[model samples]
Target chain A: MENTTSNQTAQNDLQVLRTSSLTGALERELEHLILTGELKPGERLNEIQLSSRFGTSRGPLREATRSLQAKGLVDAIRNRGVFVRSISPKEALEIYDIRAALFGLAGRLLTDMVTDAMLARLNEFLDEMDEIAQQRDFDRYYPVNLQFHDFLIRSTNSSMLAQEYKSLVNRLHLCRARGLVQAGGLAVSNHEHREMVDALASGNRERAQEAFFRHVERSKQRFTTTLEK
Target chain B: MENTTSNQTAQNDLQVLRTSSLTGALERELEHLILTGELKPGERLNEIQLSSRFGTSRGPLREATRSLQAKGLVDAIRNRGVFVRSISPKEALEIYDIRAALFGLAGRLLTDMVTDAMLARLNEFLDEMDEIAQQRDFDRYYPVNLQFHDFLIRSTNSSMLAQEYKSLVNRLHLCRARGLVQAGGLAVSNHEHREMVDALASGNRERAQEAFFRHVERSKQRFTTTLEK
Candidate 1:
C-alpha cells in the first residue's frame, strides 16, 4: 500500500512537469500560427478542433490561448471563444517605427563594440545581398535580409533587446506587407544597407544610428508607397 | 425533466464563466505583485500560501503563475516551484537603452503631429518641473517627471507602442535604483528636460528625437554614477 501511494505521487509529479512544458510549447506554437497568418484574423479558436489538430487536450490548449490573449495577439470573447487580432496599416507603420527605434539602438551599440570579425560578417551579407539584388530575386533575398537584420539585432549587448526586436519582427508579419517588397525596392533597400554598413564601418555611433534609422524610414516610405498603389 | 437538465447545463456554464474570470483577475493581480517588487526577486511563489492569502483556491493561483512565468517575470522549477527573476546592472542599462529608443520614436512621431494645445500642455509640465527643480526636491519632482514622460509616451500614434512603453517602465522597478535619485540630480535632470522640450518646441523631427534620446542617455549615465557610488 505504501509503495503504491509513493508511485502514484511520483506519477502525479511527472504529469505536472509534462503539462507545464506542453502548455508553454503549445502557447508558442499557437502564437506562431497566429502571427504567420496560418490562423487568420477573426477565426475562432475552436477548442475541440485545435485539441485534435495539435494532438493535445483542452486543458493545456486553454492555457496557451490565455497567454496569447495576454500578449494582445488574440481576443477572448465570453462563450464565443478566442480570435486572432488584426492589424491596421496605421498600426503596422507604428510597429515599423518601433522597429526602427530598436534597430537604431542596435547600430549605435554595435558601433561601440563591433569587432573586425563582426564587420567582416556584415560585409559578407552585403555582398550576398548585392548579388541577390542584381538577380532581382526577392524570394532568395528575403531570408538573407532577415539573417542580416537578425545578426544586427543579436549584436546588441542586451538579450532583452534582441528578444524584443525579434518579437516586433514577428508582429510585423501581420502587417500584410510581404508582397509589397518589389524588385526595384530590393535594389534600393540594398543600397541603403550598403550605406548603413559604411557608417558602421566608420565606427561613429551617431552616424551609424542615423544611417540605420534612415534606412528604416526609407523602408517605411517604400511600404507606404506600395500601399498607395 | 428537460427544463431541469437545461438548468443544470446553465449552472455549469455559469461556473465555468466564474472560474475563468477569476483566473484572469488572479493572473493580473499576481503580475502586479511581482512587477512592483512586493514579491521580491528569487522568492518562491508558494501556491498554498498565496491561495490562502488571496482568499482563492490553488487552481487559479497556479494558472496565474504560469502566465507570469511565460512573461519572463517569474520562473518555475520542477518540484521547487516558481521564483521571481533577478536582474543585473547590465540588463538594467540595456532596458534603459530600449526605453531611450522608444522615447526617441515618441518624440519623432510627436513632432510630426503635435498640436498647439499639446505643445502648451508640455510647456505647462516644464513649468511645474522647473519649480520642483528650484527647490531641489527629488520627491516632488519624481511624479511630475513621470507625468512628463507618460505624456510623451501617450502622444505616439500607436496604442501598441504606448502599451509597450508602459510595460518597460514597470520592468525597471526590478533594478532597485530608486533611492539613488539625489536633489542635485533632480535639478540636472530637469535641465536635460529643458533642452528636450526646447527641441520639441522647434518641431524638427530630427532635432526632437536627438534631444529625447540624449536626455535618456544622460539619465542612464546618472544611473551609472549612482551605481558606482
Candidate 2:
C-alpha cells in the first residue's frame, strides 16, 4: 500500500511538470504565430482548431492563451473570442516613447556599472552590427541590434526592468513584424548604436542616457515615416 | 421560428454578459483582498474556498484569478497553486526607478500639451493635496495623490502609457500596503508636487521632466528609509 501511494505521488508530480512545460511550449508557439504574422492582427483564434493543430487539450491551450493575453499579444473579448491585438499607429508611437524611456534608464544604469567584460561584449556587438549594416544584411543585423539593447537592460541586474522591457519589445515587434529595416536605415541606426557605446565608454551617465534615448526616438521617427509612406 | 431564434440569441448574449461582469467583480474583490494585505504576500490562494466564498462557480473564479495573475498581483505556480507575489525590497527600489522614468516621460509629454483646463484641474489637486498634507489626513491625501499622478499620466493622451503607469503603480502598491506616508512626509512631498506643476506651467519640457523624475526619486528614498526603519 505504501509503495502504491509513493508511486502515485511520483506520477502526479510528473504529470504536473509535463502540464506546465506543455503550457509554456504552447504559449511560445502561439507567440511565434502572432509575432511572425502567421496569425495576423485582429484575427480571431479558433480554440477548437488550435487545440487539434497543437494536439493538446483545451485546458493547456487556454492557459497558454491567457498568458499571451496578459502579455498584450492577444485580446480576449466577451462572448466573442481571443484575437491577435491590432495596435493602432498612435499606440505604436506611444510604445516607442515608453521604449525610449526604458532604454534611457538602462543606459543610465549601465554608466557606472559596465565592467571590462561587459564593455568588450558590447564592443563586439557594435562591430558585428556595423558590418551587417554596411552590407545591409538586415537578417543578421536585426538580432544583433536586439542583443545589444537586451544586454544593456539585463546588465542593470533588475529583473522587473528586464521583464517589462522584454514585454514592451515583444509588443513593439507586433507593431512591425519585419521591423523598420529600410534601405539606409540599418546603417544610420548602427551609427547611433556606436554613439551609445561610445557614450557609455566615456563614463558620462547623462550623455549615455541621452544617446540611448535619442537612438530610440530616431528609430521611432524612421518607423513612423516609413509606416506613413 | 424567427422569434425563437432571436430569443435564443438574446439569452445567450445575456449569459455572456453576466459571466463577464461577474468575473470582473470577482477580480476587483480579489484585488481588494490582495491590496489590503488581507490575502498576504506569498499566501497560496485556495480556489475551491474562494469560489465558495465568492458564491460563484469554479469557472468564473478561475477567470478572475487568471486575470489577477496576469496583472502581477498573483503568481500562478505550475501545480501547487497561485500565491500573492511577495516583492523584495530590491525589487521595490527598482520599481521606483522605473516609475521615476515613466513620470519623467509623462512630464515631458505634458510640457507642450497642457491646456488651461488641464492646468486648472492639476492646480486643484495641488491645492487639495496641500490642505490634506497640512491637516495630516493621510486617508484623504493618499487617494488624492494617486489621482494627481493618474491625471498627470492620462493627460498625455497615451493609453499605452496610462495603462503601463497604472500597472507600475499597482505593483508599487503591492510593495507597501500602508504606503510610505509618515507624519511629516506628506508636507514635504507636496512641495515637490508644487515644483512639478510649476515646471509644467513653465513649459520647459526638460525642466519639467527633471522635476517629475526627481520627485519620484525623492519618494523612493523616503520609502526606502521608512521601510528600513
Please report the candidate that would top lDDT against the real structure.
2
Model 2 TM-score on a 0 to 1 scale: 0.88
Instruction: Report the lDDT tens digits of candidate 1 across residue range A95-151.
Output: 888989889988888898888998899999999999999998888998999899888
Angstrom error of the Cα, residue B46, model 1: value is 2.1
User: On residues A48-107, what C-alpha lDDT tens digit does candidate 2 reach at each position?
Assistant: 999999888887777677778877999887668899998877888899999998888888
DockQ scores of the candidates: 0.35, 0.43
- C-alpha lDDT values of all predictions: 0.81, 0.83
True contacts kept of 2: 0.56
Q: B74-132, model 2: which lDDT tens digit per residue?
A: 88776688899887788888988899888888998899999899889889998999888
* Clashing residue pairs, backbone N/CA/C < 3 A, model 1: none
- Name model 1 segments beyond 4 Å from true: A1-20, A177-184, B1-20, B182-184
For candidate 1, give the lDDT: 0.81
* Cα shift from native, residue B167, model 2 (Å): 0.8
How far out, in Å, is residue B152 in model 1? 1.4
Query: How accurately is candidate 2 docked according to DockQ?
Result: 0.43
